[model samples]
Target: MSARGFAQAEYEARLTRAQALMSKAGLGGLLLTTEPEIRYFTGFLTRFWESPSRPWFLIVPAAGDPVAVIPSIGAALMGRTWITDIRTWPAPRPGDDGVSLLAATLDEVAEGPVGIPSGPETHLRMPQADFARLRAKTARFLRDDAGITARLRAVKSGAEIDRIAHACRIAARAFARVPEIAAPGMPLSQVFRRFQMLLLEEGADWVPYLAGGAGPLGYADVISPADDRPLARGDVLMLDTGALWDGYFCDYDRNFAMGTPDPRVLSAHDRLLGAAQAGLEAAQPGARACDVHAAMARICGADEGAGRLGHGLGMQLTEGLSLTAADRTVLEPGMVITLEPGVETGGGNILVHEENVVIRQGGAQILSPWADTLARLA
Candidate 1:
């Protein structure tokens, strides 16, 4: 058996917490197919999920431990987890592909309504046809448990917080080295590659996301992939990364001026920083997610065409509790979220600033160090 990342007691507490929620909601069991949900319960971590050929399932009964119904190939890894009731079937089997096994497992575990995540920010991780087949075979009514899972996962455990904080520190060290690795005239693609390497050297297990833009006054979009366009002396360059440590992620970004940025860009950067500060000040327990949004929106102004001021961060690059007017999730202690404020800087270009923090009773505790001022790279 392989070593487990989380202690057995941690897994038990998570299971107990989820089961309590399930019972309260009148759910007989929860069928989790997504990566985060499965690993959150079972401590079964692997990067083999890159292949879309197989489907894995975890059944958390309202009364007992979770059961793993997965591809036969993963049985050994599953064995290493705190979960003991492991069931496997040969996956990628043209038609069945563990659908029957999953259905049977669900039927055995649940007698009434079964809960699954089918709502916002969640995608059914199995093949569509297989899902239909499983539903038909099991004949169990499935309810949307996305909200229950979201509420449970939003609060970071002490260990989860430490992992995320470590990842933030690693990324901060890497960002500090960007001036030595990146230079004017270098293509944005090379900058991306070198920065990813730097992150690994700084102790990040993997760099899943690295996106940014470089232009005379900020970039057109924050999510655009790095292009071959060379960085110019007067350009404002931004690099946002989602680096992972122990399956937890730190989503944050940094901005740097190649030589001298436009004064408007500098002003926009300062405004964004102030907006983030406002958001942080409002991120105490009992505050709603939208309250944080309003605080930042007041500083940055409304409708700059940016989607959200910030969002909950953990398990994935983005998660539940969006920092927008529509999201009313209470900012409870232990929730880790990002404060991202974006400003449009004319000509379809925009400047974005981001920082990660853990919500505390007192206020927001910043995980990543703030970029005191816009970095100027020679």
Candidate 2:
């Protein structure tokens, strides 16, 4: 069994926090199934998340020790987590009575109104049978799936900020190393692969992964490299990479013009830099998150043809808080966000730049300290 990563006191504090949220929401207890939230509360990381045959459930009451219900085989791993008072069941085989075990566990702790994180965010995580069993037990059950969790996560703790900062540095350093591996006439995919390797060597847990190609215009989708197109003179190479450090991710992107730059590319690059700068400047205490987007949108214009500015970053590669005019979530201190400004023409000439920042009292503080200037690679 793995030793507990957090102290028992720390786990108690997390339970206190969860209970407080439940009280605020007028609920007796909460059932959380999200792995991130589970890991956050219990410091439990398991490879068994990949196995559907064995599932884990965390039942937290507003007034008692947290309960972890999982497979009998997984009960041993629960010792590594800070949480105690575990409930176990044998693996669900044909005609197995998993529901009896779940219902028994729930009945022991739940009273009054219980909260479950249902709907889109939670349906996939809970088994249909398990969900039905819980619903049948409590008539006062309400949908509170991830409601409190999102609010808690919005204001990151000091440890989380440190991890994000470390992740940001890894991404920035990886971007700085791009010039050495890129050259005109090399395939874009090759450059991407080399960049990924560099990130891995820098202690990043996974490839930051990059994309964009040579052309007169821009395209969508940065998840995969485009067709094996040979780099050409005056081609703008836009690279977007996300570094995963300590289970957190930092997304950073930059643009490099191969050979001599065209006037259009230079002008677009300037616009991107300006937009990114404006977005960063807009991040401050009490400012609505959408207000930052409105600032950047002003510079990028309402062109549906061009790429949108940047979004937020954290546990996932692309965080939902958009820096666009439509997003109105107020900005607050301790929030980390990404501001990426980009411009792409129909001809493949592209321009983009991104940076991660932590919102502070005065304004946003840049986490990744890389050059703001565009790179020209010949």
Candidate 3:
């Protein structure tokens, strides 16, 4: 199965760190409900989360191992983890769900405020009605976890960085073979479909996200779904993907020219590469996220108008901090982020370049195979 999850000691260290932070925040316990939060503490990884029929809960106490209060459907997998105290009930119980068991457990474990992740980018996976019932069943006040989860997830461990780098390597191999599936007269949609197959062939566990565009000048936007338009001699093709390896994602993209691209587009692509290089140099420990964004922004000028230039990446395709003029989040060692820069190429289109990188003590380390110039196709 794409490598057995992390070692037991890894989870132990995570729990110890979380408990220390919880105690300092004056929290009796933490109530985790989302997939990332639950998987972060326990090594319980499952595709059953896609069903969304049952809710999963993990309670991180002030001093010990986390308690997994999950559905019976997941007990076997949860048992495989390091957790010993597990509580389960037949899930989808209409009126109660797991609310009664969950609340009672909360009452027994938490004496002070129960911390829930209520900060930006956080989510409550359970139903709203059940959450209200849970609140009524327990006397504990549900307060924000004070960004504790985000703080810990922002900086990855050595093991996590290895997985991310592995994912990047898989993607890099797929990108190198793009010429085998792409050429003039080929449909853009087919290229997208074939690129996904290449990712799997190159050893990606899964490809959860892929986005790109093609145009005679540049694409109108990056997020638009691929159409049936066939590539022309003058077209500029870009493929951006978020491919996974053992649940870690590598998010970056490549630009290519069909036959011969416009001179303006080629110049814009080179400038985009230059801007990304600028971002790489600025990504250093103690530097704010905006500092890196400003460096790239200086070169892209007013062309990089697709919101932020880049964002943090790891477990999810995009997470934690952002590279924007307004975000002052400090960069730190072991934090993986993307350097994406773009520029206008006349009309309403734009040319962009992106690369995955991890902040290190020396500077920044490139995770994706670095590209200096635009690749061409006949």
Candidate 4:
């Protein structure tokens, strides 16, 4: 049971909450196709999602245990989950995938309106053509789920928070070892590869996302995919990673100077730190996401160009609410988010700093070990 990411009670509670919401929305069942939503209901975790060869589906009914309508290959894994009513077919059947079986199951479980996650950050994993076929085969219309999954997933359980925090600790440990592998003359690309190894060495199950840049003043962009540029004395190297641990992710970054730091770079780094602090402080349970963005933007200056200062992260690297002026999602206790602040250095370069935190009753609690100083490498 410890090996599983969450207990059975967690899944039960999720289903109960979702069913309650479904009843109010006049929904008979909820259709889930994507990895996160399925795993949210059932603890089916697998890297097999890497292959798009087959499609999978989970049906959350209005009053009973969710059903797994998946390929034969996944029946064994789905059995490990709390789900019992497993339905399967030989996948990739060319003209007739799982549409007939899926339509039948949907008809049996759902009465009137079956809801599908139709909000931002949600998508149907099945082929569009198959989905059209499914719609034609089934009697009930698949409508929007009224943001039930998003709202429920926004506030995590304590068990979920612990997993995320474990991932953060792994990334922080790997960051501390950066000096051992980085210095002047190291190619930025090699640095990226070696840093991922460090993350695995520390404890990450896998390093799904690692992007960074190196420049004199600052990196032009934080999402740089690492070129062959070498580190220099005044260069500021930034590495942002999305490392996973037990299906949870820790998303943050660290900045380090190659040898000697430039005065301008130091000033920009200090401002980023201050802005991150402000954002963290403003992430109280009742504050809106835009409020967090505004607090950090004030310190980074009003005309910052990085778009979003930070975003929510959990099973997926970026989900839920975003820390931007346009997002007004209220911060709730147990909502995990990142406070990333950036400042424009000269020549279109920007210095960005990020920290992972969870909204608590009083304020945001830092999951990653907080830092105030910019690190330097020999």
Candidate 5:
């Protein structure tokens, strides 16, 4: 499992790649506190971050291996990773929680400006007061290196792609059992619970996100939690999940009708599938992200007020690259992204179809089982 999750070489390669980017950006080192970024360099994987009571820190110098400065509870786990120099302190303390230690570590490792992710979709995972204190201590060496990290992580390795594909496969198997587990008159909340259990049984490490809606025309929103509304014949039901395998995530959704769907719903599903096809055809190694968006938008219509059609997926639920008209990030081989096309189906409702794929030299290789037709669950 350790080899499958990540070998020593994988971590070393990641660290080397990060150091090269830091060199190009003139950064002395990188200070990472986010869960994904920390795990990217070291093979430290744990669900302990859900508590958020203690902050963990990893410092990657421009030359050597990473150093982990974290709470005492995580020392054992961090010891198991490729990282050797581990620093720990009692966490959740009233005032001085690891700030001084982190400052000293940063000062020792980095001489010039140090990089931290401060751009889009990134968050500082520690207490604001602690951050303020750390900033005051190391004020002279701070810079935004979100782009440096983003560019390095956007393109995945073969192992990373396999992990993501395994996650996608787990979710797909769970989706296949929805027909067996769901029935008319069952509450949507119950469906969510049952489906999550199925995902776990089908080999998912966890189901971090599982949300969707059910309506006659479709659902008004896709991100809302499951409700007590009972399924009825002709209601279109959707379930979007972010399932994890090892530490990688698969972001995709599936749709089902209680009985026979409306002709229009079927037509909309067809259009969404066609849009995915167009997007897949355009997902070449050198194609811009906007090109993929435009190809899909041409089939799904440009009025999708659902923001970006899709986005990068791997370590987090959503990563750096976004498929939109404005984003110009070039697609590269080994980048795993979702092609999600949502269509407004009148009555203030919409239908969203999603599929995960890896950009290969040839084209987009589908990871999840293809939804050839809109499923009608009896």
Candidate 6:
């Protein structure tokens, strides 16, 4: 069956969180640009890059219906969305008061500074012009409001968990077919395509935005598989993908070898796997996020410190809690996180290990079946 669709309850929960965030940020309203925030508030999903005629923005006030502002062409789609208010705009003209329109729509309800979802620049979605227009009119633009949503989003509602697990099951089954699709002499790109086809056959709504790459040390600079270079016997393949369903993300990464990997590679893989285990063990309610990172680092053995152990995963790939050094976020029940402890050796050997976990009363429940050992394709 096709992956379970987004439940209406999930949408309501997200909106409630957004409203709470608006209150906490001291903003009369929030303007959600073309990224996850817009999708979260309105359940509006479209080809974000293709629609450039008029930008799609979601106006979420502390109270009342969420108003979706988009180009006239997208109005139909927005109308079908769960959000109640759908506003459309014509293509901006020479004297178009695009900024004025935004102010007019928001000025009535919003007072005080409007909070923008301005996380790290990479996470900000909308074009520079629209972002600028909103900023100039709003007294204050804030970053990290993602928490307003992330805190709510990170905890997967029971139904949302079902959809994610379904997605993970699809990916796990797809990985089982990796050996068949991947050949000793096939290019990394070709292997990735086959992996994607398996996913599509399983009825994925869309191929995940993420992709993986593999090669010898020199070629391990992972790319999006546009370069379909064939694999060699000595190649180490990196398989990383974010499979999505119902707007939620199932993220995990694995490493494989076309043939028997070097002992150095094998050792590193084992170390990372151990680190992952340590991180999972530390993922209990009341545990801090950095404490999870510490567990993984200690297991990696001195001098073998892997990168940040993992991060929170849900609506957006990387969300609220991050398992990295210096972050002191406390873990809570219902939080879903990814534990990825990895190390890349100078010689080109890369060891990647990851799993999706949900914090539980007993400790942590592994959402995805754990991979037992390094997968050797050859």
Better of 3 and 4 by lDDT: 4
lDDT of 4 by residue, 1-378 (tens): 136467799999999999999999999999999999999999999999999999999999998899989999999989988899999999878788889999999999987799999999999899999999999999989999999999899998899999899999999999999998888898989999999999999989999999888889887777769888778878888999999999999999999998777888999999999999999889999899999999999999743467888889899999999888999999999999999888888888888889999999888999989988999888
lDDT of 4 at 98: 88
Give stretches of model 5 more than 4 Å off: 1-4
Report lDDT (CA) for all predictions.
0.89, 0.69, 0.90, 0.91, 0.89, 0.70
Which portions of model 3 miss their true places by more than 4 Å?
A: 1-3, 302-305
* Number of backbone collisions per candidate: 0, 13, 0, 0, 0, 4
Worst ten-residue run, lDDT, model 5? 1-10
**Tens digits of lDDT, candidate 2, 221-289:** 444566677777777787777777666778877778787777777777777778878888888878876
**For model 6, where is the 10-residue window of minimal lDDT?**
217-226
TM-score of 1: 0.97
Q: What are the RMSD figures for all models against the true structure? A: 1.9, 3.6, 1.5, 1.3, 1.4, 3.1
lDDT of 5 by residue, 161-225 (tens): 98999999899999999998788899999999999999999999899988889988889887899
TM-scores for every predicted model: 0.97, 0.86, 0.97, 0.98, 0.97, 0.87
lDDT leader: 4
- Ranking of all predicted structures according to lDDT, beginning with the best and ending with the worst: 4, 3, 1, 5, 6, 2
Which digits, one per residue and each the tens of the lDDT, describe model 6 over residues 1-378? 363446677677777777777787776777666566677666677655454555566777778778776667777877787866776667554244355566667776556556665554235555567556766765444344544655556676676667677777777877777888887778766777777887777645566555566665423443345467787886677776677776677788777777877777777778878888888889999999988988987876422343466788776666777787778988888888998876666665445677998888889988878977888888
Model 1, span 1-378: residue lDDT tens: 122277788889988998888878889899899899999998888999999888999999888889999999999999988889999988879778998888888889886799998778887898888788888999678888847787788898888888889889999999999998788999999999999999999988898999998998898888778889889999999999999988989999999999989998999999999999999899999999899999999988755566898898988999988899988989888999999999888888889999999998788999999877999998
Candidate 4 — which pairs collide? Answer: none
